[model samples]
Target: MIVITALLIVVVLTLAIYLFYHHQCRLREMAFLMGEAVRNGDFTFRMPRKRMFFGERALLKTLNDMENNIGRLTAQNEVESWEKLTRVLTHEINNATTPILSICQSYLASPSIKSSPYREGIEAIHDTTSSLNIFVDSYRKMTQIQKPDPVELNLLDFVSGVACMYPSVQWHIDISSAQTLFIDTNLLRQAFINIVKNAIEAGARNIGVRWNRQLCISNDGAPIAPENARNIFVPFFTTKSHGSGIGLPLSRQVLMMQGYDLSLAQMPQIGFHVTFIVSSTCGSC
Candidate 1:
């Protein structure tokens, strides 16, 4: 009876050890597969939750985080490629259109050319050329996005400078702090100019600019919807018919490259507002 009991104990211990070793092997294999996927740029790969074992949950979580980061980087690369393609196409079209415009202008200015019965045709040609120029200019601006070099700037002074540039529009800037912020001065100015111009085009008699340091959150404590807000950072989205939709996106891109965050919000009481947040520590700026 004692011998039988001892044999039973030995068999149970052996089975437990085998099961433990098998689980460890499976965990290691999973880790290896996830690493391979990451190396291959396969961010879509996901580890099965049921397969995760003790001491492997953290590894799985890290892999998932890595996958998410890779996905974002891939998306950004795609956007940049598309932007480059659009820029090339616009440049080609502009080159063709510019000479045509100059020829039309020269013909219209000629005294003998105006005296002919084709005068009406010349006028129509001029009108069409002017319209086409405007169209091409809009498209050109949309495609050629400039990267900005950021510096420490006084928000109040910058706003005042922009306001002076456009005397016809009203500019109201409010800031809680007089602290200097690191920003791409030129790009920041351009962004402000674009937003202010949009406001003017929208017939907004009163344009308000406010700056604050806070996390962007909705009234319900959720992240704001990039879609409804027009996500100015996204390329090729414009609210205006004549707009190339590149201004805000370009501006936001510049700011982001300089390590800042830009956002837009619409409140029932406040209308539409543009906000900027600078990093606590300046990096590439």
Candidate 2:
């Protein structure tokens, strides 16, 4: 009887070990598939949950949830990216062509164009078109910027410079400490400009800029609606009719490329807040 009991215990232990190993193998396979899916940008595939194992089923559900979220975000990002490209193309083309067309019309209207003065106007048109082509090409390349050329910057001075561009909006600048930041000056400036423009567009009377551990730009404007808040970072999603919806997304993208984070947060008794997460050590100096 003792030998039989001992044999039964051994069988149970062996079965448990086998089951654990099998479960681990399944997990390993799932992890591999997930990695492949991420690399291939295929988020539609899902692993079947193990009904008998509650823990395994929970993990599968969590993974599936993550997959769905990633898929949705990816789709939105792609749509927004395309829309941003379109807006830039349209704006730049119009900017380049408008002046050229105006010049041509003026030349055509003047009786002097029929004389010996037509060559200069034609030359001007050629130069303008050439510049336009160059700008469009450069703009296209700018969209694919993978990284930023960082330089040390005085935080307050940089923010102040961007704020100076919009004189109509009242600016309140605060610095907890004199912090020098390492960032891409041009890219970060453009990002700041976008944020400030958004504040001005939102009918902000007073815009506040502060730097401590991070940079916080707040405006006393109408708060974003709940639904709009969720998609505020989405590319090409705009509240304004003429809004290309590119400003916030582009700013976010630039910051992200520079290893920074930008977000909209609410402050009690205050208005809309846009925060930029920078280096912590830089905050003290």
Candidate 3:
């Protein structure tokens, strides 16, 4: 009886040791998975809520803090980039406008400016002035982007209003489903308007806008040349001669403020496409 009791005690001690090590192994695995998610630029991953050992809990908290810091840094970088671009664009625009305005004034002051050649020159000046005004307008819009007061809105209705505003542009919208989303209606309208305007300037005759419940996965899958794609959301990067380059960046900023994201896809057969992903919790807001 004494021998049996001693063997039982030994077995219990071995089992307890095994269980403790196993628990530690699980915690290490969880930590590794969380680290991988962070490395992949996914700051939204959440740790499991189950109670963990004190050390494990501390490690999880550290990771969460790291993610938040990274997010804040990334946002600051974007804002700084915008400020730099705005300064450069403003300087260029002022230089161009000053020369054009001076020339127009000189032409207008001349008493003998009634000839056909002079009239053509005046028209040229007018055209340059118009272009300068547009450039200044774009710069103003970028510098003054404001936060939107969000409200629940029908996606279809909102899109319809925008399409109506631009009768000359052909919009092919494929949103047949009735989805209501909470968004800053005015800001969203401005964003879509900018996107459609860019497409038009890109020589696109037909613009297609589609929405799906699975937009998150679709957003990640869009194909773009990695080089051009990285800076698509950066301010003041444009392919157009007169583009202020703030439209897409501002659009992204608006969406991001509301816990959303935007991505670009290049369809070689169909040109470039942009996708917006609204988070689940922020869906109604």
RMSD of each: 10.0, 11.5, 7.6
* lDDT (tens digit, per residue) of candidate 3 on 196-258: 666556555555555655232121223444566556667778656877667878876776666
Residue 65's lDDT in candidate 2: 70
Model 2: CA > 4 A from native:
1-142, 266-285
| lDDT value, candidate 3, whole model | 0.64
In terms of lDDT, the poorest run of 10 residues in model 2 is 276-285
User: Which residue pairs of candidate 2 clash?
Assistant: 178-285
Give the top-scoring candidate (TM-score).
3
* Alpha-carbon shift of residue 63 in model 2 (angstroms): 18
TM-scores, all models, native as reference: 0.48, 0.49, 0.53
Instruction: Give Cα-based local distance difference scores for all models.
Output: 0.60, 0.69, 0.64
The count of residue-pair clashes in candidate 3 stands at: 1
Off by over 4 Å in 3: 1-69, 80-92, 112-130, 154-181, 192-222, 239-244, 256-275, 280-285
Task: For model 3, give the 10-residue run with minimal summed lDDT.
Answer: 214-223
Residue pairs clashing in model 1 are 150-184
Task: Give lDDT tens digits, candidate 1, residues 1-285.
Answer: 999999999999999999999988887787798788667554545566575565577666666666656644654565567568768877787787778778878887899888898778878877887787686667555455576666778877877777788777555667544746676788767766766666566555555555554222111112234464634445666655766767666655555566554444333114433333322212112
Global fold similarity of model 1 (TM-score): 0.48
lDDT ranking, high to low: 2, 3, 1
